[model samples]
Target: MSRRVSDVMTRGSRALPLDATLYDAARIMRDEGIGDVLVTLDGRLCGLVTDRDIVVRGVAERRDARHTPLGEVCSADLVTIGPDDDLDTAARLMREQAVRRLPVVDDEQRPLGIVSLGDLARAGGVDPGVLSGISQAPPNL
Candidate 1:
């Protein structure tokens, strides 16, 4: 039987409200040793903000992290999956979306966990070449 996303996903994924500042997101990422945080609005998943997002969209643009809300810089075009989905599905979604992480959500769009490329690697079923491609450093701007 194929493993489910919940089997390897990182549970208790950190989340912050849309109004939360970039600094708040950074602190959570720092303290939790995570690269991204789910952005929520009224308890529903709304977007995602990564460390790179903060640096590129917030800091590079000279936006004050202390005051700039995540809503302003977060990637709202999210591609999420569900806990019961097969790991293969997650891997495919990650590949097709060109995203490193996928927020596992419930029917109500509440984030339950996050499945990362590393998680798929650890699960040991995804194509190695795909993982390698995803792991490659992003090209310079």
Candidate 2:
């Protein structure tokens, strides 16, 4: 019912190694003005680390932010979609997973780009209000 993910996805998401310190991820997020970043291990997709992850899993837990690797706290149970997949698939994935953002992957499950709820709305395939209500709606309102 819509274009492929690659047609609308924001390509080349900002990424960092799984071993990166929580401080490192936070710094990058701040510098990039992004809420989340793709996490990797040995140059492959591993998990996703968001600002909330750092706050709840790192700060709230009293972990050593400078020493703790993101892999320890990032959300590893990802819901991803292929670059060639339709926006319908993306919408369904978002609905079923209850996530606001999804990592678009290549055939080998390598991170290629990212698609957010807004992307679907912008694509004109889904209801904006409904998608916006999903978890992690952009803080800007």
Candidate 3:
């Protein structure tokens, strides 16, 4: 059987509340050496924010990072997968959606873990067999 996404997901991923300041969120990401952070609301998955979000949306707009809330800048329309999803499915979803990170959620839509391209790359070879299916199939919604 193919490896499951949960097997590769980074558990206890650093996360932030939607109401948190952009500066706070950025600090967490920088300290963790991670590019993305899951946005939560009362311990439930709401969206995701990335370093690029700060640079492109916050910095470019000249907004005060300390004053701006993460929710305002986060991508609310998130593409996610359940922990039971296969690694291949995660890879295909990432490629089709043009997202580098995928949040793994539980039944209640609570964030359980996160998977990134780096994780996939490091764990598997460049052409990780897990993603071969994605390479063959056309993009599907």
Runs off by more than 4 Å, candidate 3: 125-141
Order the candidate numbers by lDDT, best to worst: 1, 2, 3
Q: Write the per-residue lDDT of candidate 2 for residues 1-141, one digit (tens) a residue.
A: 458989989897888998998999999899988888999887778899999999989999999999999988899989889888988788877877788889988777779989998788888866655676665444320
- Residue 141's lDDT in candidate 2: 9
Runs in model 2 lying further than 4 Å from the true structure: 128-141
lDDT of each: 0.90, 0.85, 0.82
Clashing pairs in 2: none
Give TM per candidate: 0.94, 0.89, 0.85
Top candidate by lDDT: 1
- What is the lDDT, from 0 to 100, of the residue 128 in candidate 2? 59
Cα lDDT tens digits, model 1, 8-57, are 99999999999999999999999988888999999999999999999999
Residue 30: error of model 1 in Å? 1.6
Give the winner by TM-score: 1 or 3: 1
Worst 10 residues of 3 by lDDT: 132-141
Candidate number with the higher TM-score (1 or 2): 1
Which 10-residue window of candidate 1 scores lowest in summed lDDT? 132-141
Candidate 3 residues 34-112, lDDT tens each?
8878899999999888888888889999989999999889888888999888777788787777666789999999999
